[model samples]
Target chain A: MDLAILGAGAVGRSVADLADDYGHRVVALADSTHAAVAEEGIEADAALGRKEAGDPLGSHEPEAVFDAPYDALVEATPTTLGDAEPGFSHVERALADDRHVVLANKGPVAERYDELRELEAASAGSVRFEATVGGAIPVLSTIEDCTPESVTAVRGVLNGTANFILTRMAAEGLDYDHVLAEAQDLGVAEADPTFDVDGTDAALKFVILANVLGGGGFSLADATVDGIQDVPGSALELASEDGRTIRLIGEATREGVRVGPRLVPENGALAVTGTRNIVQIETREAGSLHNSGRGAGGPETATAVLADVGRLD
Target chain B: MDLAILGAGAVGRSVADLADDYGHRVVALADSTHAAVAEEGIEADAALGRKEAGDPLGSHEPEAVFDAPYDALVEATPTTLGDAEPGFSHVERALADDRHVVLANKGPVAERYDELRELEAASAGSVRFEATVGGAIPVLSTIEDCTPESVTAVRGVLNGTANFILTRMAAEGLDYDHVLAEAQDLGVAEADPTFDVDGTDAALKFVILANVLGGGGFSLADATVDGIQDVPGSALELASEDGRTIRLIGEATREGVRVGPRLVPENGALAVTGTRNIVQIETREAGSLHNSGRGAGGPETATAVLADVGRLD
Candidate 1:
């Protein structure tokens, strides 16, 4: 299948790697500065070389995406100024041309499920964004198939960066700032990781999930979010004393949703250590199905996109 | 869809109840001694009442199943002695006629994935058994979709009877006999719960999951099985002191497989407390993804079966 990936950053390269592995031809890759088209598909290793050399592969337009036919468009761009900035138009253009969209880009999906739904209806196109929410967890696909049962509750650590920092604080006795600094140095968190640390990243992902599970476009305004920034250092110690751990839990239930750093009893399945992320989706039928692994990172998100591609062909 | 439930056992009723809720017409029921068929559909509630009141749904006959023109057949009878058992022939007969089979009965599928696979190919039928293992955690469905990715490892607490016993043994420092008594009393363990406690139950489920994930059947003998009966009470205390819990982890890796108890660190996702059963499927793409929840009983398994039906439809 011919594919075009928007954004040649970490997520874009990751998708490119999976596409190359699966032997799918990537037709286009667009970054902030330029768009590159390669009918034969860009190699993942070569793309990595370009990134290391301070020049990304999508820095020049190759013109193949415009001329060559493609089946799907994988959106991997970063979130712009507000949420619906340039990425929205990139997705709109692709969807308008009847391309099936598999999104790892959060900005377009997080803000415009409604607009995209309309585009999908207009063109009778398919849009799968399993990577938009739960990395490789398969939460969206399950919810999509199990509709009307209604996933009444969903709770988990949605952001790997905040989870990494919190896990470090609880396990290694590192303070918030110390752990945050360590995370930044290790490239686990952004230089300004406010979206992850303050729970906005998780909240956006949660909104997308809620929409799928609840059977509609649930806006950010409809959900409640709480960040880990206010969690006191002493709370971690107190949890440790009581054989517990403090993990940032983003929970949405029928009896009102809640997102915060929860003092979980250590015996729970989600009491994961290190950088592992866990998501639990509770439906009327499956009760609570808890899934845990990597919640974020370019490679993990790319793996999810590849999973989507696998399901496609 | 017109459905025929071929047993009045716990599994049969579970499937019937859920299928009825989804508005599927369950037209027939068969037990070892009797069979009931109805055009308007055998009401699940009425059948349950008959079973509770000491009536056997009425005298099994060979022609009863053949007479019904149902869309799907739910085989829920006990495992017959071998391949020539009544349930096996019954399932084969149903599939021979092109009926989709949602098997809640392990006896048939455990002994015959290939036979059933052939039958499915011959008749172009669909076979789903989400309740066969881990109630409705969607293990089979998850593994089915995980075909493109190489499943490196399949590990988790597969037996609720063993897990419940182990949890009691780990948390309260109880002996095997004492925990067994508690599990039986609470309906967590059967009167003849030897299959579950001795790890054979988990072994069969492990083989089934391996088959779906890897596209080939794995023998029960291929797995190194160990039961919870040998775990001493003092071992739990010793492990707990170091912040750990003992769980009967059924694991299958590409190199080899082992189905036995493991002393997991307290922070391990598989170190689930209470009667909750957790399974971790390690794939080439998604690194160990852990799913945990209630693994046994009527309601939970029923929920999963219903979800599968919903997805399949």
Candidate 2:
């Protein structure tokens, strides 16, 4: 398969690196200000080298990628809310041009799910966004493989940064500020860290999952969001004494979506520690399915994009 | 889709009950000695009632199911070792006739994977056995969705019977014998709990998973197996002191497959209690992916079969 990748960030480079092993060819590569296109295949090493050295691979505009002869377009751009511009327009153009899309960006799917679905319905190619939710956990594909309309509810520890802070506080008996500082220093938490600690990240992923499970017309605005910032060390100690642990869990049901710090049995499936993410999907016939893995990271998220690329066939 | 179901056991009945909801027509239904056939669609309720009343659904022979018109055949017979007979021949005949096959039985998959693959290769249709391992967890489908050669190892707590016994022993501070009796009384274990308690069941599942991950030519004999029958309560107590729990874990690598009791951190993903099953797949790019759910039970296994049937399209 020939491909064009938008957003030359960590995830895009990772996908370009691993695409060969998965028997895919990159025909176009684009970043914010640079673009490279080749009829045969883009030289991945040269493009990555130029980007690393703060140079452009070519002088073409980003929109020129849509003209490349490629089967799919991989959108790995950083997410933005509201209009979700550039990312949303990129996906719209790709789908309108009859090209498949594999998305690592959460903005387009979480904010414009119904519109995207309508575009897919009018196009010859489909859109897949496994990387938008649980990284490489195959959460969306698992739902696709099961009986449609079987999923009743989805609940999980969806944010690694928040989970890392909460886990550290519980394990080390430290205050939230201490753990947040440690996590930021270790690059587990972002410099701003507001989206993760304030529960917007988890809420965004949950809204995306809610759309995937056919909970149509759900967005971040529909969810009851609460972060872990107010959680104190004393609460963790009290919960530990009761054989429980606190996790920032996001749950999506037919009725609505919710994100909050909930108590899970210390040894239960939902009480994962460190930077791991776990999603428990409740189905009527298949019972409950739990999937856990690296919730974020360039290579991990890229693997999901490539997996979606492979499924385009 | 039209389906022909073998084995009028619990799984078969459950499949029959749920087939309509999945938009499938059961054209034929067969037990060990009786079979029913209808071109339009079999009446699931009447066939089940007849079987319950100790009467055959029809006068057709078991082999007569193959002659009936159907798109797929569901094999849910009891598993047998060595030849993996009846089930093996049932799958072979279906694939040879160019029909899709969905297996809920482990005998054919674990014992004769290579031959079944060859048959599928030669046939117009395909074979799917998601029901053979991990019940409704979508283990095989998840592997298929990722890079085929990226899987490094697979480790899991695969048996519900042994896990139930182990969990009871640890929680109640009781010995294995006491818990074994309790499980048997609750129908969690069969009258002859040799297969599960002796580790044969878990080993079979691991062998099947190994084949699915492209580690073919493996059978129950290839696995290094050990049962949990002799686990002492003192061992549980000692492990608990270190915040660990004992689980019957089965692992498959390129090297080989093994099943035995191993210590896992009490709060880890693999330390699931009661009858839950968890499989962790280690990959090169995706890192580690963990899936957990019910590994057995008529409805759960039937749900897997139905899911595979949906995939036949």
Give the best candidate by TM-score: 2
Instruction: Tell me the alpha-carbon RMSD of every candidate.
Output: 3.3, 1.7
Predicted complex 2: CAPRI docking category: medium
Could you report the DockQ of all the candidates, in the order they appear? 0.47, 0.73
lDDT of 2 at B288: 92
State the lDDT at B142 in candidate 2: 78
lDDT of 2 at B4: 96
Fraction of native contacts, model 1: 0.55
The Cα RMSD of model 2 versus the native structure comes to 1.7
* Candidate 2: fraction of native contacts reproduced: 0.86
Candidate 1: tens digits of C-alpha lDDT, residues B6-44: 777777777677776676788887776667788778766
User: Per-residue lDDT for A101-181 in model 1, tens only?
Assistant: 888877666677788778878874578787887676767666654453557777887888888898888878778998899
Question: Model 2: runs farther than 4 Å from truth?
Answer: none
Candidate 2 residue lDDT tens string, A98-176: 9999999999888888998999999998999999988889788778766548888889999999999999999999999
Alpha-carbon interface RMSD for all candidates, in angstroms? 2.7, 1.5
For residue B200, give model 1's deviation from the true position in Å: 0.5
